[model samples]
Target: MEAQHTPDEKIVKIEKTILRGTRPRSIGYNARKGTHGPCITDVVVRLHTDSGAWGIGPANISQEKAKGLLGSKINEIFKLPFGAFGEGIKLDLPLWDLTARILNLPLYRLLGARGKRDVQLYDASIYIDDLNLNDRQAVSLFKEEVYSGIEHGYHNFKIKVGRGSRWMEPKEGIRRDALVVRTVRETSPAGSKIMIDANMGGTLNSTLELIRLCAEYDLYWFEEPFAEDKLLNLALKSHLIDSDSKLLIADGEFHPPNYFFELVEEGLVDVVQHDFSDYGITWWRSTAAKLESWDALCAPHTWGSYIERYHHAHFAASIPNYALLEASPGKMPGIIEDGWEMKNSRLHVPNTPGAGITIEKKIFDQGLDDRSAFSLSI
Candidate 1:
């Protein structure tokens, strides 16, 4: 994204751009394969705007799933405007996430966020392989797999558990659940913070009990430990705790742009997780604007094509209410692996442009459909 305009503040003009492709198709488990898993077959392009003196913005796509309505419409997308700079960063994932980032760098700079030194960030792992990985070994197993992340400078952690109900009960699931936390805490730096995700894995009784057990571990927060539509259950569960555990996250499956509203307006979540693969960046940006004053830390959910994750880096780097960016187990491929290196416990922001990586023509040719339907704008 580039720009030119306005004398009042700064002048920069931005034009819409498109980056399209057939995304990667991967179907496997904790080392196995499933009957039929979702595959993302398109690329997400973010937007950027500049003031006469600088450039800024967020993503236009959050999570990029090959199975969704947006995925099928990969031929195009647009950005949120910036009549006002540094305003309305989102807490949920959406397409505008891309546009906002390019714009964010400059706005945040003006707002006193000088990038990494000004703020330290760590990526949280959203989903986990529960089928192959046993609940009993959840934490220890998590540690074993993410050791590289620890080594790579990630300290904040998140675990996914909706895959099964083993973690839903206090008497039955708490043992294994506790073990997961114990093992992670034991193996991680003493100061390392932890987040657990239940993905609505329990009954009201079970969720409440599990929450208490989680409280004992000095956890950073718990995510979606109850069912999505269980409003009453969530209400009853809400009354069970007296302490402010920092947050109760909800990564409700594909709630889209309404995800944040449902979670926040209902007083259900303290932290919200949205991905480029799911909501597209437009929704993420609008939600950010709505959520900015609420004091909620929006962590963008991620797991898909390299560019999506690459796009999220700037997303996390740009927003104010931004809490964490989802970091995959691998060193993120492409330029992140080749150009910059992690410093401390966070990803080093790239000084390069548009993801800082050159796409292999073949990857696009082999991964995407060549028809006009797959063509994008810029």
Candidate 2:
């Protein structure tokens, strides 16, 4: 008979990690009307495990901070959780306060994810939201992102739409979006899934119209068709979409937790998003439990570092109702895919014990340091 490994025997220590990173120049690609911007900057965190495994996490800073200000306070100063940074900061910060002491980036991520072992991540394609761009340019941008995603061996893609898309336009916002959808769908290999997001930009009339329009495409899910506060509108949408056939997803981001809770109880939400940036890992984990009980699937709103992805992955993987994790690149292109990639859509969770991702020393050197962070027990 095989021997069972006891929990006490395998359990290890926990520690906190703070990661500092920078994207000196921001690059933006909007597919709608072919508009790209140069204003993206990022802060990354990683947790390290006692056994040396690592997970990756990223945090979002406003565009205002990283704009054209080289050698700015962005990296030269390290603000504590409740330090000089005023009320705008996430006051009860747990992880960042701990990991900042260490020099290793990936080492930090492994630890933050509660040492979950490994995380297989999904690729979230870049955004090109300029609807003003010509169709040809839109198609080209779609193909470009698709190419990049395919190169990374990813089979899923997301398209951003719906600012005034809810408006009843002569051009038909849903129809226009359909063109973008069809274009992207054509570029992928068979069996690939496509999702569309409105970014909370439409109205009641427009949302219903787009939802119906999306139905034609057979999408994997439709996210935030109405603004976060449109409870009545969401209720109406719930009435519109029969949950079993397709998903009417409401992300627990930008929107409040109460809204998600109510929606889940009513069986109105098929899929809901859980964001760590807004709630940290603890709150999101609890939210995951609630959603799981209701038989609702979850996808994390992963907008920051790869470490954030690791945190999301743990919740996404542990839940049986986990749909697809929120996918995107927290670092520059090709950083995680080359040496750190997983095979056949399955990424090896950080095996080094903690977060499992490793950052190249040269790249770490290039990262901006807003002072330095102190470490702690996770």
In terms of lDDT, the best-performing candidate is 2
Q: Could you give me the TM-score of model 1 versus the true structure? A: 0.63
Model 2, TM vs. native: 0.66
Give each model a TM-score: 0.63, 0.66
Query: What tens digits encode model 2's per-residue C-alpha lDDT throughout 289-356?
Result: 67768887667676545445544554443445566665553345323432344554445443232233
For each candidate, the alpha-carbon lDDT, in order, equals: 0.45, 0.49
Can you tell me which runs of candidate 2 are displaced by over 4 Å?
A: 1-122, 129-132, 163-172, 229-244, 329-340, 360-368, 371-378
Q: Where is model 1 more than 4 Å wrong at Cα? A: 1-142, 162-170, 229-237, 256-263, 331-340, 361-378
Q: For candidate 2, what is the total of clashing residue pairs? A: 62
